[model samples]
Target: MPYATAPDTTRIAYQVRGQGTPLVLLSGQANDHHWWDTVRDDFHPARRTVTLDYRGTGMSDKPDRPYSTEGFAEDVIAVLDDLGIGRADVYGTSMGGRVAQWVAVRHPHRVRRLVLGCTSPGGPHGVERDPAVSTALSDADPAAARRTLLDLMYTPAWQARQPGLLGRSTVLGDPAMPAHARRRHRLASARHDAWEALGHVTAPTLVLHGTDDRFNPTANAPLLAGRIPGARLHLIPDARHAYFEEFRTVASPLVLDFLGAP
Candidate 1:
């Protein structure tokens, strides 16, 4: 229930677990700290994991205004500063990656290492999500929405083989991120343009993506790695946007290794 106040005075609720070098986690669009519920424990006892609710989601304040990726980046800094964490390794997925990109570029001193997963630098050069995937994200029926996400996120073969996985996994639904917030997040993400600014990032970076990702194509991975000096790229075959969820055995180890966590 700890809260960090952003410059705009928005309170960001966060939680810290385990014991080791701080590892700040930023979730995707419309997602809150709960997004990390499943994989978070894997990093415990080796790396301290910090998860937070983005503004307009979870326990944070929801302002009726436009949002920017830069503002989200500042939110992360506020959390770190409030915790007295000088620097921490950061892992940002999907939209979170966009925010993290800004964090690395604008506040290089606050991040030691960066992990951008299933994300892009944005702007005209970035690939767009499949129409079906976009429709699913905006679907009204809860069950239908979940189905759409499962289909777009996990490979079909994997879905058929492990039908129970979705039920057993941590809930991905966010009732707190209402229609207004979702639209605000989407609007902010649409304006994200870190393509040219990536060069300013000094943190060692790792870009992870799945070849079968329907939400964000794998081609963007190399684009990010190429732009950020010394960044490494890793691609998982047959894995989709939720590769970290379905292929945790493979993805977790890769992340742990990259972060040098035991």
Candidate 2:
């Protein structure tokens, strides 16, 4: 477990693997680096991969306050500084994509390339969950929250294939998550609005979304692709929010091609 002390003195845990150009992987809401294991090998064989557990998510120290996107962004910069990495490509999904967007706008020189998956620019057009789902997420029982998340995360087919994965994921999430962290995560998410910042990003960008994504629709792909100069959009059909898991064979190759581009 490699740990870096953030400016706020919070210890962030991360893992580095492979070799070549550094590529940082940021997980989605409530998820850790394990979410990338499904597609890690697909990145260029020569590229180095860095995956970290956000402050409250995995092996990292969870603080009670300052869980804002700005705070998380600072944590990312702290990691780069600690590692002595001048710049690196970034791949972010869902909430992590929002962080990546912030990184590009705030520290443009540090990003070589950017990949946003199953995410949006966060504005009026951004996707929003049903009120019921949202309410369930804030419930006292972590299991209920987990079920609601699972419902929004994957399509019916995925649920059928992996019956107990959601329960297990929820159990793992409950112990690692603190109420304060969850509240902060929600606040950071609700307050996020990146539409105005898109034009500030100069890195080569790629947006990937699934046609059947209920949580964040495929329309978001174009919204993002259109906002970032030279950004390209790829839409996977018959896929849902968890497109990477449901369609890894297709998703991985597309990602590999995009990131491997010269």
On the 0 to 100 scale, the lDDT of residue 87 in model 1 is 93
Q: Candidate 2 regions off by >4 Å?
A: 136-142, 169-174
Query: lDDT per prediction?
Result: 0.87, 0.80
Colliding pairs, model 2: none
Q: State the lDDT of candidate 1 residue by residue for 1-262, as single tens digits.
A: 8999999899989889999999998898888887788788889888999888888899988887889999999999999989999999999998899999999999999888999999998998788887877887778887787777777777778778886966654435566577888789889988999999999999999999999888787888999999999999999988988888778898888998999932
What is candidate 1's CA lDDT for residue 242? 83
Clashes of each: 0, 0
Clashing pairs in 1: none
Question: How close to the true structure is residue 241 of candidate 2, measured as C-alpha lDDT?
Answer: 76
The TM-score measured for candidate 1 stands at 0.93
